[model samples]
Target: MTLANGGDNIGIYTPSFAIRSAHEIIVIAVVFVVMTALWCFVAHAIVNHPKLGSPIRRCGHRVTPFVLVGLGVLILYQAGSFGLLLGRSGF
Candidate 1:
């Protein structure tokens, strides 16, 4: 967004940038909740229904475990990294 505003600097926080970041965080949270719900639905479908939708069935059969682990790792990484950044940001 700063790029759209013609600001080339990185890591320089303006009020607008902070507002945009807040909005982005909200969006990320909503997406995370939706994805988690979908994952649960797909998992339930795969387990309870033998003839589930093919794409979701394939994903649940093959990718669900790995995706779960990856989600955990990603959450940890993002938390730690953003914490470090906030700590350094003089807040």
Candidate 2:
């Protein structure tokens, strides 16, 4: 997921920059790696802590599936609309 987001950020933001060079790309990659590592460590610590972990875990279990289902439904709706549009256009 982080990789996908990084790729998307690169795709969406890189073109507007004045200089698109190896140095810039390397810097972006390094920053992305560091930030991802930092966040992973933070999340790990939070999830493993004795005080807060249990409630967070329980909430995650309850909420994650519904969030995923919502995303799935949204994707399906968009795809269905696109398909309908294409068909109407005789594509």
Candidate 3:
């Protein structure tokens, strides 16, 4: 059975939207990758800097993994949303 709101069984439908042209998928992927990398870089800097703001470094270390996981989830959700838009539009 399928769970509510999760859409675990949903297939790739193509009858609603077109988030962008086929080329847009590549752009979307690149954007997501770059954003994720940028976030990681900043987070790394925060966790690695010296003296000031360094006390939270440990906390940053503790939360960085979770933060990365959350970012990953967000990226995945965006990807799904994009696909949904394309699928909805019957593209």
Candidate with maximal TM-score: 2
Number of the predicted model whose lDDT against the real structure is largest: 2
Instruction: List lDDT for all candidates, in order.
Output: 0.57, 0.65, 0.55
- Give me the runs in candidate 1 sitting further than 4 Å from their true place: 1-20, 51-91
| TM-score of each candidate structure, all chains considered together | 0.37, 0.42, 0.36
* Count of residue pairs whose backbone atoms collide, per candidate: 0, 0, 9
Tens-digit lDDT string for candidate 1 (1-91) = 2246444233233332454567786886688689978988976777677566666655755876697567555554544544555675332
Please report, as a residue range, the 10-residue window in candidate 1 with the lowest summed lDDT: 8-17
Error of 2 at 42 (Å): 1.2
Q: Where in model 2 is the C-alpha error above 4 Å?
A: 4-23, 61-91
Model 3 vs. true fold: TM: 0.36
Evaluate residue 82 in candidate 2 and report its C-alpha lDDT on the 0 to 100 scale: 37
Model 2 backbone overlap count: 0
Model 3 scores a C-alpha lDDT of 0.55
lDDT of 3 by residue, 1-91 (tens): 1234253223321221233576866786688689978987986887677864578854657876797567555654544654555676221
